[model samples]
Target chain A: MLTFVVFSVRRAWQGFWRNSLMSLAATATMILMLLLLAGFWIIQTGLNAGLQFIEQKVEVVADLNDNAPADQLLQVETTLRGMPQVASVTFVSKDQALQDFRARLKARGQEDLTGYLDTNPLPNTLEIKLKNPQDYGNVVDYLDGQPTVVSQVTPIQNLVNQVVTVTNFLRTVGVVVLILVGLTVLFIIVNTIRLAVFARAEEIEIMRLVGASDAFIRWPFIFEGAMVGLFGALITLVVLAVVATPLQEFMYGFFRVLPLQFGTLVVRDLTLLVVGAGVGLGVLGSYVSVRSYLIR
Target chain B: MAPGSSTGLLRHPTLAGDRPPETTSERLVLALRDVAKTYPNGRAALRDVNLTVPEGDFVFLVGPSGAGKTTLIKLLIRDELATAGQVLLDGQDLGRLPRRQVPRVRRKVGIVFQDYKLLPRKSVWENVAFALEVTGTPGRRIGPAVDRVLRLVGLAAQARQLPTQLSGGEQQRTAIARALVHDPRLIIADEPTGNLDPLISWEIIQLLLRINEMGTTVLMATHNAEVVTALRKRVVGLEDGRVVRDEVGGAYHRED
Candidate 1:
């Protein structure tokens, strides 16, 4: 087995170099396909992250009655935090609300009309964030039930429904597009490697006639395919690495405020994804291509 | 040159004198009984072809183009299964052989083609060593085995040259060396000299006869009547997929 593996590797190395032009062509195709796949993957990841950020911002705000006691407001915050769906609940006192309204007016370069009133008209409010935006029904219902302490709850149900509908649709489309691109990559890579194998049909025929086992004829091509994949992946990664900073900058500038950072985890996952897809497609392509010759 | 004079030098260390003796002198190296083959296109390539070649026998398959000579060779190598009846090589039914066992069975037979089928990029020595390498022969054994066969085919000096660098005869000799590298029980040459001139063709025939004299069964398919008639070996004639004649000490054509 060791001898067989050593022979296969040696042959694979020689086969790759001997057919350098064909091998390079296949590698170039692989790199382009992998880059396309990785591009879509990055977009999908960013889309998901942006959608999540938007969903987290879908908070249910309830205005408390001006006369509601501090203890009641504290109790409401604790109760909201206890709920599984409620991610966090922050209570803003009337004074803090007045201050925020003044700050917003100043930032927007609008006159602070609230200063003209004899008394501050702002209401103390509870901002409730949900783990999942779709699960906002129960939290809204609970806040509405507290009629004594809460004067009114903002009717954002329609807004939440619309946001969920659009985000869900976009997510679905992203996944479907990724899948279609993945399959396209599979076929193009397979066909490219098939052409390479076709070029060596005479060699394969000679091997078959000489009583080479399917493994002997197949593994070398497979290893060669893997070599193409490895080279393609390494080259792709270098390209990606070179463009990564600018790509991230462009993404940040495009989406501006969206939390779309390519963290260490993302980098690692992308590296794994590129290498895995490159090598996997290469092996599968060669396996399927060489199978046609071996079956006979 | 004499028929058996080259046998001494062609003797394989592991396969010639040191090889185990056969169980029977009459053991059949190849047998096709009522074998019929119709390709997927409904072309009946062979029908009712019955022939047997005993161990160490030399036979010539003579037929016009499209007369099933190639189909008959395909059956022996298990390249195509007989549509009807059995093809037994060394007494094992090819039709009954499993897919995985095909390679093992193929190793028992060495095949040569008119095109020479040598890898253009590989040198003559590499081309011969390729057969053993692909068959999983040990690296240590490959060099000597390849050297022995190249020497046997009288191409040892030109082993380092590529196929295109050699003449048509040398390329065919390289192919023959590859076929012999396996020390196979049966050597099937399908129009091996089809591309060669008369003089070079005679040289190939002499080399084959010498290999046959060294105790390997040879079955050659040819359209070369002159060599076939001069050799006076067993000849099996196929016409439109049927074996019309089978004769020992036969000429390429009928004696009538």
Candidate 2:
């Protein structure tokens, strides 16, 4: 068995270099397909992360009456924090709200006219972050039920519903597009390897006539296909590595608000996807291509 | 049992008539009984053919073009199945052998084509070693076996040369060396001398005859009438998908 394996590997190596054009062509196709898959995969990852950042923005805000007592405010804060669905609760004072409004206006290049007001018109509010954005029902109702201390709670159910629907639809579409691209890559790579195998039909016929067992004839081609995959994957990783810094800079520039942590995750996922798909597809293409000639 | 063993030699002569009839399988190297082959398109390539070549026999298959010679070779190699009847090699039926066992059966019979089928990129040494290499022969055994066969075919000096560098006869000898490396019981030559001159053809025929003398059965399909008539060996003739004649010590054509 060891001898067989050694023979197969040696022959596979020889076959690869002897038919350099065909082997190179197969490797080229493999690299192209992997890049296409990785491209879509990167886009899908970005889309998902962007949608998550949007969903995280959903929260319920309860406006406190200006003259509400300190003890009542402490009780409300404690109650909101104790709730299972609420991730956190932040109290924004009237002064802080006014300050935030001015900062936004200045950031947008509009003049802050807040100095004309006799007093701060913004309300002190408790911002409630839910563990799940979809689970805002209980928290919103509880805040709305606090009539004495709370003037009004934002009715954000309609807004949350609309955002969720659109984001979910977009995610589904992105996944469908990725899957379609993946299938196209499979067909192209498999066909390319098939052409390589077809070019050596005479060699296979000679092997068969000489009483070479199926394993003997088959394993060498399989190993050669794997070599193509390995070479393609190595080259693709090199290219990806070279372009990575620039690509990251571009991503940050476009999606500037997205966290750097999400970018790292995308990089990790892309690496795995490219390597896995490249090697897996190469082996599969050769198996399918060589099978037609093996069947008696 | 060693290949080409004659079980007939063990028979007791005193009670031969009463010992019951001998079945054909025990003595035959290859047997085809009532065999017929028809393609999917309904073209009949062979019809009601019956042939038996016993152990250590040398037979020539002769006929004009499209006389089912190629199809018959295909059937023997299990490249095509006979639509009816059996093709038995060494007592095992070729058609009934499972797909996985086909290669094992093929190793028992060495085949040579008219074109030589040499890999242009491989050296003559590599060409002959390729057969053993692909068959998973052990590393230690391949070198000696290949060298031995190369010597037998008188191409040991040209072993490292590529096929393009060799003469037509030298290339054919390389193919024959490849065929013999397996030490097969039967050698099937499909017009092996079709591309050679008379002198070179005689050289190949002499090599085959030498191999046959060493107890390997030879079934040569050829169009060389002079060699066939001069040799006066077993000849089986086919015409229009049927066996027109079968005779031992026969000429290429029938005697008056």
lDDT of each: 0.83, 0.82
Question: Tens digit of lDDT per residue, candidate 1, span A19-48?
Answer: 678778778877887787788778768866
Local distance difference test, candidate 1? 0.83
C-alpha DockQ of every model: 0.64, 0.66
lDDT tens string, model 1, B132-202? Answer: 88889889999999999999999989999999999999999999999998889999999999999999999
Worst 10 residues of 1 chain B by lDDT: B8-17
The lDDT of model 2 is 0.82
Candidate 2 residue runs with Cα over 4 Å from true position: A6-29, A39-59, A63-124, A129-170, A246-259, A262-269, B1-26
Query: Can you tell me which runs of candidate 1 are displaced by over 4 Å?
Result: A2-33, A39-59, A63-124, A128-167, A246-261, A292-294, B1-25, B41-43
Candidate 2 structure quality by residue, lDDT tens digits, A195-273: 6567668888998998888898888777777788888888888888888778877876776655433366767777777
